[model samples]
Target: MGPSITDVPKSVLQDVIIKLPTKSIIMCKSVCKTWYSLISDPAFAKLHFAQAEAYPMVRPVDRRSVSRNLYLVEPEDSSGFDLKDHDCNRSRVHMNLSKYKLPVCHPEELLNYHRNGIVMPSHETERKVSMKITQIDDNNNEVDLGDGFAFMMQYDHNSYNLVNSCNGLLCLSYFFGNRPAAVCNPITGEFINLPHGPKHEKAMTLIGSGLGFSPRTNEYKVMRILKEQTPDTNKVAEIHTLGTGSWKSVGTARCSDSELSFPTCVKGMLYWFCDKWSGCSVISFDLDTEEFQSVPSLPFEDGYDVSMGDLGGSLCLCKVESFEINVWVMNDSGPQKLWMKKISIHTGFSRSWPRGVYIPMKYFENDGLLMFNSRLNAFFYHHPGNHSPFIYLKLREIKYSSSEAISHVPSFISLKDILVGKDVEILNINSRCAVLKLPGETEALSLVEENASF
Candidate 1:
């Protein structure tokens, strides 16, 4: 025998497993049954995720925690990654990335601003909805997420929305069975359905919804806005707290004819661009208080094509004013302060909206550079306001869809750990090899329990 069964102390063993990264933990699962049990414990994943937060940037995280500031491009074929942009002299760098898939009606990204490399694609055939996932590494390799079979593998539904993603959790807008929504950890192959709410008449149907995290309370909340689409209708807001499993009325918000914008979380509030007001402007929703507020108007006329985005840990507004794109940041939080215009660049546009537009994607912290990507070009601008004013910048012959591009550092915070599981399944499995299987195939996470050993 290699060693006695009781030779090692259980306390010491516990300490060792919690210190390893996600990759190491996955490989070690196959080493032995005992090791798999320890690493697979939901308690251990929670402990490791919580303790790992204190890790400093100096330590080399060999684990793929996502690139610091990488831009994602979707070629017309929706398969291979392109590298024609590496010849630039800006601080932005390019790597040889491979292909991945987005599971939406449009070839657009399902979630944005959330820092996790995991992406879920849903394919429905003959009435059953199959959940397929892929992980895009820094190497551009599309890896499988975990070792679990299809979720909602057999269900009678045709319509669903890939609602919102924060941390490593995905919020499905569709009501599974009778539930209002389903919150799933695509990484762990574990999902919890939210309790169902009262069905409304056709007049008060749901028009828009979003999810956000409160750093202060350390809780995740889903905000679903229901509207009648009538001229004098008042929009209703329903808030769902993860642990409560119930959606509570957060009071109705008044603003007719306004459309909801993509949700952006900052500090403890959610911001979005909307025409739901007299003028098309940004709106704010508080995470802690569950209240809604309208942000002050940006310094622009009513005719400019404008959008809101998160830049450098703050809320930024981009407007196509005159022949240049004006980049502005909110100097203060909440509904106060004026929009500060910082960078201006001439990109050959006029009063009309161009056939394509450049959306701000990423901001480099180590260096002061901002990058934006459009349908046919990827551009970067260095801040400090001392460089040449929109001169002959570098060009790359890469092709991406006109869809939205997003960038963030991937994190390993488990959805199960964050939302404490009571009747939930905490299977001892790994995410790296829990590959997403094709239609009519059999696989769960990475492997079936009987065949855990590779």
Candidate 2:
């Protein structure tokens, strides 16, 4: 390399690094400490993220080659690559479900757009005594969600629920009995309490709750839907705006015996399935207006075993039938009739694993690969283009009984940066953490003297 190129200025170097593919950036981080410092900086990360957002066309993954060697980028060019797609708190609600010998995927971990597939291999069931969160990154590599995140919540792993996710923020509810909710940036492990809404004299099963962001108002919100049974079912709506302390009433809606799955937020609006006596309809609540309306219903019949998910960046509904799961993506959000049946995946009986249900955890819109787990420690990537073969991906290290993976987007935005009016505190994890401090942060906030060294 010539001296001019070798001696590239820091500003010029920043552009070069930002231009590299996501995997290359991680590789470049190890080239030298200077490169690591530059690439890992919060400001640089935000700039790189903005650049990636500007080019949003996701490219599909290649089936012929599973190795990183055949890595594909946008426009089918790896040179000027555009590899598409794809936290926390402590007091860690580390749920180790290995002892039960049952499937332990949590619907609550579905907190964001790029849902992470949490897994614990079947072999290592002993780690439940010391629970750990296993998360899969974009490169198909697994990362642990350690630090006091689970412990900070002070709840048994079974009681924690991931409410909603936007941009990169996550809302989690703790409910061994109490229904206290909190919003936190899993990357930075910075969280603030959301004021408790209408108190319950006795513990009750919450209908569901969601977290969202309103770009127009520049605010984040936590919406909880409470249901009471025994005396005919009735539903109550309560909302808490981030940066604001208390939750306010959003009025109430009549409840039905039919099932309503968790909410998925899109463009500042929250949507959930409303299975009423009338029919199955998708009910949406505008975050900015705080108004509720029924826009559209599922394309299928009322009770067809349906589940909602974020397919890539679009809102998707998955209909699970006998052995095939039909995935429908809402191509155009403007009209209710624009649902395009993108793909159908066959999950029929197999000689090796019969009757094991494989659920899609992360949908790679660009590459057409749907990541899933049929059982504990068992993970596979299903490419819709090719149905006959399923590519197996393995999770190494940290084997507990239960594990969770949700769609996650790594970001430079800190909790303090988003929560403008509120005070922020970092949870002290009683365990060791691999990554500490928010990206671009100096001196770890609330530095626990013993475990400060990352």
Candidate 3:
């Protein structure tokens, strides 16, 4: 008789299971009692987690292949690279769900189905293109509300807007007219309009806002710091919770007009850089507790503007000087001690003073690297630093023009046709649910196989 199949060494089995796709791992849980026991080991799970974490959440090199030419910029040297050519390429490359090999269903699918296959836009739009949406569902077909959904928030042509997404909801605010705000679940096509607050005269000011979810209560909240007209008063911070339907005030003592920047939300709290004429501090607001606290000044010399972002899972403060950028990652205060690492800056542009430029750091799920840039009009897919040695996306050539008027120019790039690259891989996974890729497999090939049966 042939040898029993179960004779494989435990070490060999572990290696095989670890290399399998996540879906396959779940399937192997039912293969046999031994296999199931091996797969369910906490130590094995931790090893897999460490392996996954080793890869960069967002590979800086991968940004090179991302398509950056979405708008038509009208530069002086318009050597036949006009709007028509750009539109033609956009139409040709516009993502089609049936064309990619996605492992999981997209949240957009459920959102569209709820709306008769129409994804709702935050702003009114006449331009319509056919795009498929996919909803994420568990084994039981229930929605996964922890990972947030992504969707479009439309605004006027020349407006500044800021968006911070957390826990399946997005907080969107526009910096034109009354500075309207809204909370939207792109996956559910459900959005609640926020009450417009008092208007401000300064149109060029940066409006800081963030969205966060409270797991304890399952409630969502939005926070904004607007420049108050009465700069001398201490009423600059404002907050709005999803269920409350209106803006509320957070009373922090006012600092000098030039010292306040938009707040960055981390760990259920909103933080902002505060340089009161007396000293520099980081002001934080705990949304759940409704309490305010302040952290000591960042480790840096004077005269540098500090910005906050998420690095790995911790909060990081970035200080940029001429041709140099210093990033400090805050660590545990006791056991490990506070560890700060410096990322040498290669971008040569003089560190411009923090203005109303809405730079929101987006943490990619693939790797742990934090991604963002200073260009407001550029889409999130493009890299903005000059040291990257990649072709610059000419904004003039790719700028969007109104179909009706020859000279009607818009302020912001219309992202109606833009596709988040993350969605492509996700949809591929949902459809197959168990396809394993070898180490050297190309993304394009994986995408091709993902869409083969769809």
- Identify the leading candidate in terms of lDDT: 2
In Å, residue 115's CA in model 3 sits off its true spot by 20
**Ranking, TM-score, top scorer first:** 2, 1, 3
Using TM-score, give the best candidate's number.
2
For model 3, residues 155-272, the per-residue Cα lDDT tens digits are: 1211213354443334555433224355443322234455554444443233345666454554566665655445443345666655553566676433445444444555666666
- From the highest lDDT down, the ranking of the candidates is 2, 1, 3
User: Per-residue CA lDDT of candidate 1, range 400-439, in tens?
Assistant: 1122334322234455557633554433222322243322
Q: What root-mean-square deviation over C-alphas does model 1 reach? A: 13.7
lDDT against the true structure, each candidate: 0.48, 0.49, 0.39
TM-score of each: 0.58, 0.62, 0.44
Runs with alpha carbons beyond 4 Å of true place in candidate 1: 1-92, 96-164, 174-180, 184-191, 229-231, 276-278, 333-335, 348-357, 366-374, 377-403, 420-454
How far is 330's C-alpha from truth in model 3 (Å)? 2.3
Q: Encode model 2's per-residue lDDT on 282-384: one tens digit a residue.
A: 7667899887765655677764466565666677776666666677877654655467787776766543432333434455544444443424433444554
* lDDT (Cα, 0-100) at 26 in candidate 2: 60
Worst 10 residues of 2 by lDDT: 95-104
